[model samples]
Target: MATLLHLDSSAFHEPSVSREVTAIFRKEWEDRHPGGTVIYRDLAKEPLPHLTADGIVSALAPVDSHTPEQAAAAALRSELADELERADAVLIGTPMYNFTIPSTLKAWLDQVIIVGRTAGEGGSVAGKPTTVVAARGGGYGPGTPRESFEFVTTYLEKVLTGMLSLDVDFIIPELTLAKSQPQMAPLIDAAEASRAQAEQDAVQKAKTLAERFAA
Candidate 1:
């Protein structure tokens, strides 16, 4: 059975655009692949500890009789990396916060993107497909006011692609905060429609990759 790793990093619980969109993607994916298993990681709920000096030392330290804290930190790193190795697909849920991703999500990335694990000299995560459900309060597309720059989408795509060799796909739900946009009902409807279309697109993309590999 295929394994899908779902990660949600939005701090805004129910009103979170990223969370809602990702839920749609997950449901549709499950519907399409009955036996697929999904592993959920909620960064907001379970935050990873910030890297400490000792932790950094431990990370650079050789694997030996390490302290309990060091061992635990190391284990967390290894576990996160292992999850990537095990996953057939990864779904990332993120919302722009001040033109960047939530700190919690970046922290998680720091944990998993280890040298010689997620990427390194010995072929790390060379072929994985990752889908990102990204949403913003305002428009972030070309020619928009806030579109001048945002590092969240571009950075994630670049880092994930380079570190994991992941075929990245992104769904950007823009203009949610636009006054010209419709009311709550229509806004929700539009978001739902965008999510539906993105889900189909992601599945087709992954299926095509799978077919190519199988061939």
Candidate 2:
């Protein structure tokens, strides 16, 4: 049976566009593979520590030379890497914060992006299929006023595709603030349309990917 690694970093459990869309994908995936395994990680509830100097040194140092703290840090990194290595596919729910990914998601990336493990030659997760549901509160697509400020999808694409060599696909729900912020009231219609389209895309993508991976 296929195994999926699902990560959600949204702080809010309800009314989160990223979580909503990712749920659609996950539902479709589960429907396709009823007995398949899903390893879910809620980063907001159990956030990972940011990489420190000691953690960095421990990751590069020989296992035998690791101090007690270094060994602990190395172990955590190994666990995160193992999750990615064992998964047949990955799904991540990322809500844009300050125009980029949440710090919790960044911390997870730091833990998993190990040299020779997930980066350069012999990378464990290299070429793994990954789907990212990126939700942004404001419009930041091409030609938008804040286009340059959009860093969430761009950054994830760079790391998952460029760095880890994962086959990454993105499902973005834009202008999510339109429903809650008074200033964005006029854009609510467009935002709803975007969200609806994203949900549909997520279903199709999930089904297709599940079949491909299960085969």
Candidate 3:
């Protein structure tokens, strides 16, 4: 059966666009594969520890040579990597926090990426399909005033593709705060349209991947 590693890192669980979009994708995928396995992690609820020196350095030495701290770090890294390796696909819900991804999501990336293992050439998850739902409070695409400040998609694209060798796609729903912020009432309609498109895209992507993997 196909397996998906799904993660959500939105701090505001009550009204989170990224989380909703990812859920749409998951539902479509589950509909396609009733027996599929999904490994879910709500990063905000149970955040992983930030990557530490012990974790990085542990990759350099023999497993037996690791100190107690390094041993623990290495074990955690292995567990995360194992999950990624077992997954047939990956999905991440990351709301833009200060123009970038949430710290919890960053922590998950840090722990899951290990040089010459989960990352680098011949990485365990190389070319694996990954879908990222990047929700932003405001418009940040090209031609926008804050386009230069947009880092969520750019940064994740680099890390997930350049470092981890994953085949990545993104579903962006911008201006998520337009409805909540009175001053941006003009953009509420646009926001709604963008969100609708994102959900549609999510369903399409999910079904396509599910069919491909199930074949």
Candidate 4:
């Protein structure tokens, strides 16, 4: 049976574009694989602790020499990384905050990025398909004035691909604040279009990956 590791880090539940988009993708995936497993984590609700120096040192040193605190941290890191290693596909939903991903999501990344374990040659999860839904309040696509400030996708692309060697793709719903912010009122139509396209992409991508895994 296929396993999917799904993560959502949006603080807002009711009106979060990233959460909504990710939900669409998850539903499609679940529908296609009734017996499949989905390992879900809501980072906003149950935040992971920021990676400590001890956690990093524990990975480098022998496990038998770990202090109690280092051992605990190491265990947590291993557990988190194991989820990724077990997954056939991975999904991350993170709304942009101040032009970057949420701290909760970053913490999750830090905990799971064990250099010798998950971030190097012959890593357990290398080449896994990772879909990231990066919802943003404003447009930051290429050629946009804010494109230079788009750290969410740029940073994640490097980390997910360069560090973990995962095959990464992104589904972005931009201009999420169009309806809420009066200054963005004129962009409501454009925002809706982006949302619609993102939802469509999610469903299609999820279905394709589901079939690929089921094969």
Q: Point out where model 1 deviates above 4 Å.
A: 179-215
lDDT of each: 0.75, 0.92, 0.94, 0.95
Model 4 earns a TM-score of 0.98
What would the TM-scores of all predictions be?
0.83, 0.97, 0.98, 0.98
Off by over 4 Å in 4: none
Candidate 3: which pairs clash? none
Model 1 C-alpha lDDT per residue in residues 1-215, reported as the tens digit of each score: 67778999988787776887788767766766667678899999998877665556667788796788888888888888888888888889998888889889988888887776677645467767788988876646777566677778888988888776777888787545543455544466555566566566655655654444341
Best by lDDT: 4
**Taking the tens digit of each residue's C-alpha lDDT, what string does model 4 give over 1-215?**
89999999999999889999999999999999999999999999999999998998989999899999999999999999989999999999999999899999999999998887899888778999999999999999999998999999999999999889999999999999999999999999999999999999999999999999994
Q: Clashes in each model (backbone N, CA, C under 3 Å)?
A: 0, 0, 0, 0
Lowest summed lDDT over 10 consecutive residues: which window, candidate 3? 11-20
Q: Between the candidate structures 2 and 4, which one is better when assessed by lDDT?
A: 4
> Cα lDDT for residue 210, model 4?
98
